[model samples]
Target: MRLENQIAIVTGSGGAGGIGEAIARRFVSEGAKVVVCDIDEEKAQAVAGALGPNATPWACDVSRSDQVEAMVAGVVPMFGRLDILVNNVGFTVPGFLRDLGDEAWHHVLNGCLSSTFYGIRAALKPMREQKSGSIINISSAAGIGGAPGLGAYGAAKAGVVSLTQTAAVENFKSGVRVNCVLPNAATKSLTAWFDATESGRKTRAAIEAYSRCGSPEEIAAAVLFLASDDSAYVNGTVLPVDGGLSSRVACIDATIE
Candidate 1:
């Protein structure tokens, strides 16, 4: 019950198996009322229905600032107040930089970076007013260390990290804590890319060599830590929930020069 009576909004939670859904479920289990938002109305409703009365479904295209602002504006009226926001809406289009077109690049950047910007911008007013809030942006190991074929994704996610730090610094004194989680979980998104490319195979092997592959639940646990009072002193930091993968270099050559 760490989040007892708190109200939270988790974006991009409508997919069949997404990290956002896991975070929403975890929040509910901790006694928080959650708004499960997604671009797909049906999927959002399904997740909310499964989470019972503690969760409500909202349809929103987070890449659009108007929709995001409206979503945040509606939260307090429905739930009484906003206490937590998990900006978890993002997807990757795996391809080398040369192979990716401008359309693809903008798509990834808008989805991963602009969406986060929209979420934080919209959530800040309410959070600042309350004088207490937590904003957890979902980042990726690729964002930190770079991935061979995930150029656009890595760049966009890296932007998320920078955005989180800036937001945290600007809002900490106002009582709104902003942080990020670089998750290295084996989700459908990662698995799809892994099954499709040689670079993906190598990346997965490297991750396995460093640590056990993580699950959505494990990532959800980390999100809980950031979202709850447990991480009260934490802000403007990038917490890698990647099973120690971020702690070491992924290079295979280990011989001493």
Candidate 2:
């Protein structure tokens, strides 16, 4: 019950077996009231309903800043106080950097990076006034380095990390801890990407470092740590729950002269 009596908002929390849903469940199990938000109204309601009365469903497009702001503004009125916000809304259409169309490029950036900005910005005001809150952002391992076809996704996710750090520094004195998590989980969307296309399957097979996909529960555990007071002294930290794939650099060959 680390989050007993607390109110938390977890975005993109509708998909079955998604990271967002896992996080929402973790929060509720710890005694926090969670708002399960997603682009799809039915999905949002389903997840929330299954979580029981402590969970409420919210439907909105986080890529739209107006919707995001409005949602955040309504939270305090509904729940009385906001304690945590998990920016987990993200999507991407994988393709090569040079071959990507403008629409896809912008789509990836807006959904992944801009959406993160909207959530953090909207949550900051209430958190600042209360002088206590936690904001956990979900980034990706692709952002840490180059990926075969995740150029747009990588770039957008990279921005998320930078934004989290900046927000953390600015809100340090205000008691609102901002942190980011890089997760490599075997969620529905991720698995679909690899299984839906031939190129995707090839890429998945070739990648040895991250061949082992972690469960969504593992990622939820990291988010819980960041959301709770256990990480009170921690801020502006980018934690990797990617099973060390990001740090797996190839062994350089050197000949002794």
Candidate 3:
């Protein structure tokens, strides 16, 4: 019960295949009263129901400022206090930068990047006043480096990492810690996306082989660490739970010929 009686909101926690859902369940297990918010109403309710009394569901689009505000305002009355905010709503498209359409570029940016800004802005009022809170943004390993088809996605995620660090420093005095996590989990969405593309299929297999492809549980563990007091002194870090992939390198010339 590390988070006993704590109040937490996990955005975009509808799908069984998303990081948001995984974080919600993990928070519940840690004794937090979890508020599951998503654009998918039914799916959100279903997950909330499964988590029992401590979980509540709300339909919200993190991209919308009004919806984000309503979600936080509603949660405070329902749960009495807000201690943690996990920004996990994100989407991606696989295509080269030159081939990507304007709509696709904006969609990727809105979902992966703008949403994080909205969530943090909405949560800051309460957290600042209370003088204690933890905000964890779900970034990706692709954000840490350049990728073939993730032009927009990589850009957005990288912004999330930068946002996390800046917010942490700005809010340090208020006791609000902002941290980002670069998780390399093999969720269903990723698998299906890879299955549809040749290069994706090959890259996915290679990634799985080298990293063993982490489970949602593993990512959730790192998240809980940041959420709990164990990481009180830790802030503004882009912690990669990616099986050493973040620090790895491939040598092109194996021999010193």
Candidate 4:
């Protein structure tokens, strides 16, 4: 197993088939102990429960610095090692900047971008002390270019990419690797949302790289690579598992009107 005896924390791992849960499952299957962290305690427990003993449920609102800090502090003492940290918590509200409300704006910024900051900040101490750790921040293709109705989300995700690179550079001397992933997961909710609206359907149809959307498992595979020794020499990389969405103009909207 690539991650044998490793300890990992995967935030936003509550949803049954979301990318976070898929990552947690992948980590555990590879012989790592994982903390299934999410804001929803019940959902966290549910996912953790299914993953068995190697997965522990952790109720954490990653957007809250206090909660994130506390969670990271508790990991090493409990697991005896902090090997991998996947900052996978993110959500978005769709609206043009002009029409975007304050609450929606802050929520998107805090949840998607600030949450990444909080996780990385808290996890850095332990990873630095250990002298060997991997931190993978989940970014998005939305951050790559113009996302018409997703202004706040795009900005926050863009921050994630910048933050990942800066963290990687800062931690190089400490033997810690920080990377980022732009994953376009074709999870149930996303598929349904796309199917429910003509614009969403058009957006899905615009994907040029593959005939189908990338699965959660596929995204997990990319993340597993960055988290394990396989990526020992790799650092500060922003890998896109978005089926080439970031490459060209897939500017179709998956926004709520």
- What are the runs in model 3 whose C-alpha is more than 4 Å off? 192-197, 251-257
Return the clash pairs for model 1, or none.
none
Every candidate's lDDT: 0.90, 0.91, 0.88, 0.91
Residue 152 of model 3: what lDDT? 95
- Compute the lDDT of residue 2 as modeled in candidate 2: 97
lDDT of 1 by residue, 1-257 (tens): 99999999999987767898999999999999999999999999999999999999999999899999999999988877899999999888878888999998999999999999999998999889989999999999888876777899999999999999999999968999999999986487776776689877877777676686777888899999999999999999999988887888645649797
Tell me each candidate's TM-score: 0.94, 0.93, 0.94, 0.95
Cα lDDT tens digits, model 2, 1-257, are: 99999999999999879999999999999999999999999999999999999999999899999999999999888998899999998878878988999999999999999999999999999989999999999999888988787899999999999999999998878989999999974586676777789976875574544457778899999999999999999999999997777767746536599
Error of 4 at 106 (Å): 0.7
Model 1 misplaced stretches (Cα beyond 4 Å): 192-199, 252-257
- Runs of candidate 4 exceeding 4 Å displacement: 208-211, 249-257
Clashing pairs in 4: none
Residue-level lDDT tens digits of model 4 in 9-75: 9999988989999999999999999999999999999999999999999999999999999998888
Q: Ranking by lDDT, best first?
A: 2, 4, 1, 3
lDDT of 3 by residue, 1-257 (tens): 88999999998888776778888999999999999888999999999999898889989988888889999998887777799999998888879998999999998999889999998988888999889999999999989999788899999999999999999988878989999999875487776767888976887787765675777778888999999999999999999998877776744425576
Q: By summed lDDT, which 10 consecutive residues of candidate 2 come out lowest?
A: 202-211
